[model samples]
Target chain A: MKFHYPNGKPYVPKANSVAPQLKKYKNQVYSNRGMTLEEDLNETNSYYLERKIAIIHKKPTPVQIVNVDYPKRSAAVIKEAYFKQASTTDYNGIYKGKYIDFEAKETKFSTSFPLKNFHLHQIQHMEDILKHHGICFVILRFSKLEEVYLLEAKHLLAFWARMEEGGRKSITKEEIEELGHHIPLGLQPRIDYIKVIDYLYNLS
Target chain B: MKFHYPNGKPYVPKANSVAPQLKKYKNQVYSNRGMTLEEDLNETNSYYLERKIAIIHKKPTPVQIVNVDYPKRSAAVIKEAYFKQASTTDYNGIYKGKYIDFEAKETKFSTSFPLKNFHLHQIQHMEDILKHHGICFVILRFSKLEEVYLLEAKHLLAFWARMEEGGRKSITKEEIEELGHHIPLGLQPRIDYIKVIDYLYNLS
Candidate 1:
């Protein structure tokens, strides 16, 4: 697949096989398949920001940057840095006077979306957002089926709590279809998330 | 000054110069300034984000990452990158039901703050923000004096217009004191910008 960088130049990954590379990391072994989900969402975010429809941004995983090298003075190259676990969702912004916060995940499973894709901190963050009356949801993409669903945080939290009581560790495709709304891809606005947001807010 | 990294480790910069090294290419000199005013604002932003007061961040100077090295698993290092001009202001976010946008700058000059600290694109961004009813301003820090001022964008534009009419290339200290509000440093928040913001919003 041909892709362009933010500078309009062609973009190609240094590691040809990102899945295998990600699997080598002990912590990310199970979370390896959906690399493209992040890239696609990033592109979609740029689309939203450029049109001024919203100002959402993917917060960079907080990194403890140490030992930066100033080679001749261009940009400082971070020689050593360690990723720090983020305390909030992957994406957050303001849309139409409401705070919007969400995380995007993709899974290969055809029948169910596994609960392991989310972390405890993210769940707590969503609960906090809910308390503040902010709009929060997760965008789950079934890569094999090429379908995306906007699942509200309320539904997610209910399922999450049920898991502790021996409920299903995953939400079935049927459940997602019933509880969530599908987001269609378009030319101008690639992901069309705001449409889902509008529906969720107005309907609720 | 002693500081702890996000990982709870001590942060120690290389023993070169505390001042940021400058890289000059062609005719333009890019000063790293160890931590530029941009970096200070980023720290202040993190402080705000962590405390749940506001969410503001510096838009990474859009970079064209041409080559990245996947050295160790899960780590992507940019081997070659080039800076691309940004289309918007450095900082923006929502606070207390209002959109906030601003640029930060530091001037070494003791008497006057030079107009060259700002770019045309930034001025245009502030204009756009003002047009959309967003709260926009410039954060100016006089380093030698250890003082910071929040100058409204309207006042900035007024001076910028006069620049083309062969006016002074910078705003005098007296003008800043008269036209802008001084930001008092605090213990917990450090930079109490939102207080100044509240004053700005309520005054109007």
Candidate 2:
């Protein structure tokens, strides 16, 4: 009779029937799961983990826990805590015997990625990781274009420093096209970033 | 008037006065601010971080937040949450261009270190990391003796497999001493674990 979303939006089955435009409907159903770039990346990481391909994970959201109540022996209820800005990038782990760390953030603005998307400390942390010869990068997602790019940390650092030097507050889309590696869309692993890593590493 | 502890016990400052046994008190003060092995390691990691010697950080305790409230424009308060057993090790970081992941645990028993200190998933996580050609280990601390040792994951895996086969559930102190590297005590960076790492890596 009727198909509905959790939000109670009624679905029209006829429009999505198997026909000439089935490919369009198939693509819609494929990406039907509206996941943010971070969630999709996490799923990609899990795919990597399941096959023993990589051991990367998004660090748990940081919180400053202050008080707790032990209601039972098994459960301790936290009473007071505040979210804390992470001192480093959001995700980090081992990939092909190398340390891989990166931050994933999406921008609705298609023309340029804003500098405000990253914090100063996070940029500093990337610098620190680079000093230790670790791999660092940022995943920039332009939702309008459905494009994701792996932006090298060194390039990001250069652009970030330019902001402090009174340059542009954001990097234009054209600049990102030139400086970053585009991540191909996939089915099992939504964003296969390690392929980009191999490409970037071999280049250096 | 007499110096006293907050517990109302009078402090014996005279016994710690300059004498042949003063060195004992000095050592006590040096290591005896009463920090657990985990805290000492964290401080040591910080010392390394400050000097740009290495970048290591203890992951924050993970919590599952079920309810939160926004009473003000800028503040979000967490009302209910519970601690979750971490899926991986207690620490993971990049050191010397390599991924270092390890768990640190302390036991009061002088004879053996209990296998119960680690969860099955953590052991599996280590195996996964090792498969990726990353370094993984366990730092065992004998709190009573103030002794710490770094045990490689391969050695730990062997003992874990032995236990699954109905072998001893714990590893004896002697076995750990033989297989692991003893962390030397120091005035600064109290637990010099990187030294143990240098020793272990050179062996391989």
Candidate 3:
């Protein structure tokens, strides 16, 4: 389905074709796909910040640093560390007098998104946010197909419930297309999510 | 003047000191007397987060990366970087349906706290938050005297205005003790700033 902005400009992912090289150092793998979903969201956030539209930020993943090396006077090097489970979503902030929280993920699958992509803790966190009347959702990007969907936590919860009942473990792309709102990319704010948010808030 | 909790526990700076070896690795030139005011505030924030009292965090200072080394499948190593100016305060979060923002600073001097410790951008950020009706303040810790003060943005702005007009650029410990509320240290939450917030909210 074609997504159009009120300004008559068709939405396109900014720098979608330019793949940035991933950097790795000392047995660590970092995903570098031109511009990461995180980077795009960050750029969009900066755009919002400059216009005073909202105050949102990506939360750093909590890490338990086990070892460090002091080679010089200025820098601290983490010699050994393990990924610690994050207690909350990656992004949160305030907009229009309401609290906003979300996680962004990208998949290469064209048919459906895998349920394994999200952790149990993240799902629980979303559930808690929903209970508090805060805006919560997942920004899913099918990178291979270059499609993005803003799936509300309500829909996610339904799927999660089915999974708990030993039903289908993942929501199919067809299901997403039917249930989720397509978030079109834009120039100023690459991921124009406020419109999706407006829709969700009114629906709720 | 010594600050004591109502429970008869003395406020001690070295209660949660980071290890000296870790400090050495981090190239922390500041005194290892205890967890710096920032560390204590971070711990206090963790306490609040665990109990779901608030969701405050210190924003890492933005850094401009000049060089990075990628070796094998490991985390990317930042070879060279420069600190970029921050446009906001170090700490911000939501508390009791209101936005909370503040900066934590400590002083060794017994009588006065230096104004030079705060940057102009931070002052502007506080002003912006105040304009937006957010609760903003500074967490001032007199380490040598082992006292903490929760001074409102209005008070700091008053001092800043005087400083602009060729007045003393620092707030004396005596003045802070007179105008600011002393935050009592608690076992569960350590620096109990919520109590101070309640006082400020009631006053306003």
Candidate 4:
């Protein structure tokens, strides 16, 4: 099945030949490990939760429910609804007395991550979180290269500012490699983002 | 329009005549102020957000989408879906470099606040947050009395422990008043729960 944003953009497809589809996980490495970045993060959060290490969770996809049916004795069926763009990042929680906030995005493109993947409101949200002293970041997954990196929200804001100043609308692989912390994929927690947080924040 | 939970219990009614309905706010005091606790909190959060005082948000309602219809050149329509029980608290974020988490609930009952207003999973979530050193609590509103209280998660946990040992299923108004900080309602930042937080946590 395919899902789309209310703005008429495709959200996720069961299978996609395109570069930006979130569910483009039918590849060999992804199939061997898990599916999408979302699945990995969910697994990682569950692991963290069970071990009492951290308490992170992906916010549910926001939907604008228009109509619902109260069928007798069964579940209430949402008859008509539209996907609403999230005002904040995808994932957030508490880790070691600090608030954590982040968004996860994956691209099949091997060289660059387009700025179009994020909305303006999300950028504003990250800015607000940073001002409030929350640990804020973005998890960028290059699916084709089988590499993931944790980029602090500040770097993204810088790139956004550059874009606004008539620079390129995407952050290149080299730039990301320089500014972002590489998150090595693991078995138990899958995407060990908190490890990056620990190293960056000197928690360990 | 009326919406029901997946369990077939009424979620929100345009006008509810019975108790326990989340939308039972058609009274004079409520109409003079805001309609519901949710509206007030949302307004308060907005006030905080605008001033960069805190970075808090109410998590979106979770839904299990079973089917979608993607019409050509139009937004994808959720054809079938059901509400899912949230496994975490309703609200969480950062406050003055500390992680903050809480659930807000209002009851028509003037004598006591029902423990069943919360689920066990939410309690577990709060426990996890508190163990991680996050500031966690519950915001309770007594609609008939036009009063609000911020009960720390620790107190609620103790109450839950007593309930598990076959104690009363509800926290009496006296008990809540004794243990919880009263949140005086006002204009702009309506609930002003953060004032109670600053006082309790010595942030003031």
lDDT of 1 at A178: 96
DockQ of 2: 0.25
Among the numbered candidates, top TM-score falls to 4
- Give me the runs in candidate 3 sitting further than 4 Å from their true place: A1-31, A60-86, A131-133, A154-169, A202-204, B1-29, B33-36, B59-87, B161-167, B202-204
Best by DockQ: 4
Q: Across residues A22-123, which tens digit of lDDT does each residue of candidate 4 receive?
A: 233234224533247877888899888878899998898898777677778997888878888888998999888889999988887899998878877788
Reference-based TM-score of each model: 0.67, 0.81, 0.72, 0.84
Q: List the residue pairs that clash in candidate 2.
A: none
For candidate 3, lDDT tens digit of each residue in B1-204? 233322346544334344555566345434454346777787888787667777676765454344455668976555544444565677776666567778888888889988877766677667656765678899998897788899998888777766665678799888899989998766767798988898778732
Model 2 Cα lDDT, one tens digit per residue, A1-204: 122322346433222122334334334433532236766887799888978878998787788666666675577787777777787888899988999999988888989999888877688789889999999999999988899999999999888777765678788999999999889889889999988988888731
- In what order do the candidates fall by TM-score, top score first? 4, 2, 3, 1
For each candidate in the order shown, give its overall lDDT on alpha carbons: 0.68, 0.78, 0.70, 0.81
Name model 4 segments beyond 4 Å from true.
A1-35, B1-35
TM-score of chain B of each: 0.78, 0.80, 0.84, 0.83
lDDT of 2 by residue, B103-125 (tens): 99988899999888887768878
| Candidate 3 local lDDT, A1-204, one digit each (tens) | 232232345545334221222233211344454246777888888777667777677765454344544577767555544444565678776666567778888888899887767766677667756765667899899998888899998888778767666677688999999999998887778897877887777732
Clashing pairs in 4: none
